[model samples]
Structures are given as C-alpha cells and as structure tokens.
Target: MVPDDLLLETRDLTKDFGGFLAVKHVDLRVRRGAIHALIGPNGAGKTTVFNLLTRFLSPTSGSIWFEGRDITRARPAQVARQGVVRSFQISAVFPSLTALENIRVALQRARGGTFRFWRSDRVLEGLDGRALSLLADVGLEDQRDVAAVELPYGQKRALELATTLALEPSLLLLDEPTQGMGHEDVGRVAELIRRAAAGRTVLMVEHNLPVVAGLCDTITVLQRGSILAEGSYAEVSRDPRVLEAYIGAQA
Candidate 1:
C-alpha cells in the first residue's frame, strides 16, 4: 500500500531532450487524498513534467515515486496499473462511438480485457451497470447513447473524465482539465472534478486560477522548469516572483 503520508513524490526530477533541458530539477510532493495543482506560465515545462511522471518520456535524470515505490523506469502501462492515470488535454473520447460504449472501453481496459477487443462488443454487456453509473456520476446519463462527436464540447470533456475515472485510479493526473472551456462549462467541470476526487488523489496542471484557488488544497508554481513558489492560492498569488513570471510570460 502507498504510504498515507505522501501518495506521490519526485526527487530532483529532470528531463532533457537532446541537450534542451525541458524540465530542470523539480521536487513535487502530493499528499494522499488531496487535490494539488501545478500552475505556471507557458514554456515552464508543466506538460513535460507530466510526460516524465507518466513515463511517456524518459527522464534525463531523477526519479518518480508513486505509492512509495520508484516508478521512474516503469512503462506507461505499468504505471497505469499501479493506479496512476492521466487524461489528455484533448478529450480522449471516440468520436464514432456512443458515450456508453466509450466508457465501456475504459472499463474493459481497467479490467485488462483489451485482448478481448477482437470479440464482439456484446461480450462487454457485463460492464453496462458500472458504465451507466459512471455516466451518471458525470451527469452524462441522458447522453449515454449519443455519439461522442455529437455531444457538446463540454459534454465530450465530461465523457473523457468518466472514462478516466473508470480506471479507479489512486492518482488522477489531469493535464489542463478545464482548458478551452467557457465560463459555465468551466464551473461544471470544476464541480465534476471535485466530486470525482473523493477517496482518490488528484494532481492537475491547470491554468484556470479561480478553479485552482477553489478546488486545490496545495499549489506548486513552476517557472522556467523550476519551482517558483509552493503554497496555498493566496500565498502563491502574493509571491513577487510568480507575479513577475506571469507578467513576463504575457509580455
């Protein structure tokens, strides 16, 4: 079992791509059952860090520990099986599939049943109840039969989230969960994430400051691939270096 004290931790995490240091020495700590936000301006390497953590990119150096075990060398599938899952910036919904079918695929994956993909989808009837419940959890019950591509942009994002939750992840890494959402959709997705986080840990990279302030218990601000500040929203917002970084980024 992962230690209750720290569900995920990084030690001097760094990543370089052909001499271009995308992520510098970074130490991240996420507590069990907490919502943590990693915020920074563009080019600060937030996504690069996510890639390293998920094993999408091999780190030039450093280590990642999940559930108190070193996962720096683990494959993406291996890390996912260890209960760390991530949602992409673009919704991972299948455009041609119905929302329910999309969620069923995730359920099948969580059960390591992907090998059965060659079989008829009717083979997945046993997962319907759980898929329906997940749909309801994300307020997509009414649209369960709708094609993912036909749903509104916001609902598509909701569907993506439901699929991720299907994995029963211990640590859910959301890369910009509210990216490109309008005001109403942003509020809705924020609430959805809030509700989904119960009994699990969430570490997200979000640019929506209000959403971060309202939902996250801890915030780590990255600048130029290094931590600029670490604190609550109020505390980080007040930091001069963070203010300068944002200002400089915008300029």
Candidate 2:
C-alpha cells in the first residue's frame, strides 16, 4: 500500500529496449504537494523515467501507483484523464495561433469541450477570462495577441507552460523546463514554476543544478540507469558517489 503522504510511487521500475537496459529496478516516490527533481548525467535515463510515468512508454517491469491506485497498465489518455499531465523538453504550443487563442484552446480541452473551431465565437469567449488569467500568471498577458511562433524563445516556453497549467494536473511532470534559455528567462520560468506548484505536486527532470537546488524539495540522482542518491540538496550534494557520478562527470 502507498503511504498517505505519497502522491506517486514506482516499484522496481525497469525498461528494456531489446538488448539495452535503459532503466533498471528503480523505485521512485513523489510526496504530495512537493516539488521533486530527478537529476542525472547524459544517458542516465531521466527522460525515460518521465516517459514511463506518463505512459508514453511501457515499462518492462514494476508497477506505477498514483494516489495508491496501480496505473501500470493505464492507457496514456486514461492517465491524462486522471490528471497526470506532462510537458516535453521542447516547448509545445500552436505555432500559428495567437497566445490567447492557444490558451483558450487548452481551456476548451481541459473543460472537456470538443474542438469545434466553427463554433460561434461567443461560445469560446466564455473561456477568455480564465485564459487571460493564466496568461497573466505566466507573465505573458501583454503577448496575448502575439503569435506563438513570433514570440521570443523564452516567451514561447512560458506560453507552453500556460497551456499545460490549463490541464490543472494534480501531478505535473516537467521535462527540462529550462533546457534552453538565458539567465533572466530561466529565473522567470523558475518563479513561474514555483507559483504554479502552490497547490499541486511537481516531478521534474532538470539539468540545471541551481534551479533544482533552489526549487526542489527532494532530489534524486540517477546514474547508469540506477539511483545513486536520494535526499535533500545538502545531503546528496555531499555524497561522494554523487559527486563522482554526476557532478564530477559534468565537470
């Protein structure tokens, strides 16, 4: 049985791609309402773990439990419907759509409305207030009418985050949220994430150690497809093995 404080749990999770074992016997537990980070060097299978959690890829072994319910066999849509939503490493938004329009579309989907582009404009207008609020939450209110493709790269990522927030996920999975950005944009997005995580749980695979240290409540370090250390930033940062496997490798 999963503990009451745990929002998500994986037991001995493993993934095998033919002869290559990408992830092996991993146990992950994300506490409710905590910002947890998974950090690792290249090919340490951080993204693979995210894929398995989101049901984008099937796990070769082990079980996934969310809110104490086994979700190992759940379909991707089913998992999403249950409020486990993920954002990719790459920014994902409608390139041709205006920022407001993009957010409105996400609102429609979240509210279970079918996509009906031909619907009366008035029908969609009902969602504008909420969409605008979300845009403001991400500091993109001024760009509401700007096309996503035309927005600067940082703003584009912020827009993508807004759309993801529309889903109102209980457990939000962010993959490399600050993968490509300047220092200023990184700080902005980091603040946005902190605000967005107020009432929800976040599990992220992040490469930026400073962001992970500042934002994550718990950090899990992976190396060669296995967990090398799991603890607070202070604890794990002092671990000699973690230093050698992840921090040292990066240096």
Stretches of candidate 1 off by over 4 Å are: 1-4, 117-120
Highest TM-score among the candidates is held by which one?
2
TM-score of model 1 (CA atoms): 0.94
Per-candidate total of colliding backbone pairs: 0, 0
Write the residue-wise lDDT of candidate 2 on 125-187 in tens digits.
889999999999998999999999999989998999899899899999999999989999999
Model 2: lDDT of residue 247: 80
Candidate 2 regions exceeding 4 Å error are 115-118
True-structure RMSD, every candidate: 2.1, 1.6
Clashing pairs in 1: none
Residue pairs with backbone overlap in model 2 = none
